[model samples]
Target: EGVAAFVASQGTLSYQLEHFVDSHDLLGRSVCSMGSSGSKYISSHEDSDSAQTHEGVTVVDAGTWVSEPALWVEWTHTGRLESVGETRIFVIDAERMFKALLHPGLRAVATQYAGEFHKRVVTAKPPLASYPSDIEVPHADFCGIVCCMAHPWRVQIGMHAFRKLAAAGGFGTGIAAHMKSRLKHEILTGRSVLVVSG
Candidate 1:
């Protein structure tokens, strides 16, 4: 649900814009040239005799042409701006912020509603076919049901079934005990098990 929400918020257009800007700035940094050219020639003049006077001169190509100085400068500046933008995005961490904003409300709603619904269902439903007695009954049914309830469509279906069972007052203590045992086993083993009785 969180992932879905995040993706929905950052639709394809936003993703494309982010990608384009990132790629463009990366290319600019790599392609733009920015450095001073070194002197190409060294010159020395000297006089001889007892004491000699010497002078050295370094010659540079002052008129050397840069293919696109203005363009390079622009690209460099753009790259810097892009980098700052990216850093700001991370520094702000909007994804984390969004999650923080949504988590409390969503979690509270799911916990209160879903837990009560599940409990009422268990209290009112007939026990699922007895374990081992109903050879056709799947051992993973409870776990599967839990997983299904997590899905949006199945959540509604599950809630409906819970309400019906609760209204009927069909669930028994034995079934609840069986479910508790199965849940305990799952917690211990780090694996899910179905409690058909519950």
Candidate 2:
């Protein structure tokens, strides 16, 4: 399942997942280009016993990759989005989420995720941060509070999403939504804080 925000419905063959960083410096600029080619079905691991198409991808400056001796391994490096801040930051698996969302037959899961996300968007408090961190509170921590909040600017993305970011107009600036609607529960077992309006 690929976790991407279809900010615009324009007819473009671009799969840019929403940026998952808090960097106003990168606003309105081309970050980088990304490419995903896991179908080549080449052996990733050195040992054939556990070898599989490890979702390897190589860089293509001319929008094309030349088959060379260079071995492409799964690596995630973010220089542009990495920065220190006073606010607590939580790191989430942006790459895995996108892989799941972009999967061919996960349309139902993608739709559910989108609807659930949008529902949380307009709420007084929505659980945003997940993973290991001190400030990373869960929905169960503050369920049914008068309000909830997350730094709308901060998000985490993988190399796949980063590659597509520059072309998709420097991440998603605006998220669309309908009139106020009831938020649905997509996750049930997670323990996170939920804020409610007072």
Candidate that would win on TM-score: 2
Residue-by-residue lDDT tens digits, candidate 1, 111-170: 443443333222321254221100011222334445544444234434444445545664
Q: In candidate 1, which residue pairs clash?
A: 124-170, 124-171, 125-171
lDDT tens digits, residues 1-198, model 2?
211211111111222122222211112211122123211112221111211223431112221111110111111111122112222222223334445566554544334433333333223132443211111112312222211222121111122233354355643445323211111111111222222211
TM-score of model 2 (CA atoms)? 0.18
Model 2: residues with Cα > 4 Å off, grouped in runs? 1-104, 125-198
Model 1 CA deviation exceeding 4 Å by range: 1-179, 193-198
Looking at model 1, report the run of 10 residues with the lowest lDDT sum.
8-17
lDDT of each: 0.27, 0.23
Q: What is the lDDT of residue 62 in candidate 2?
A: 21
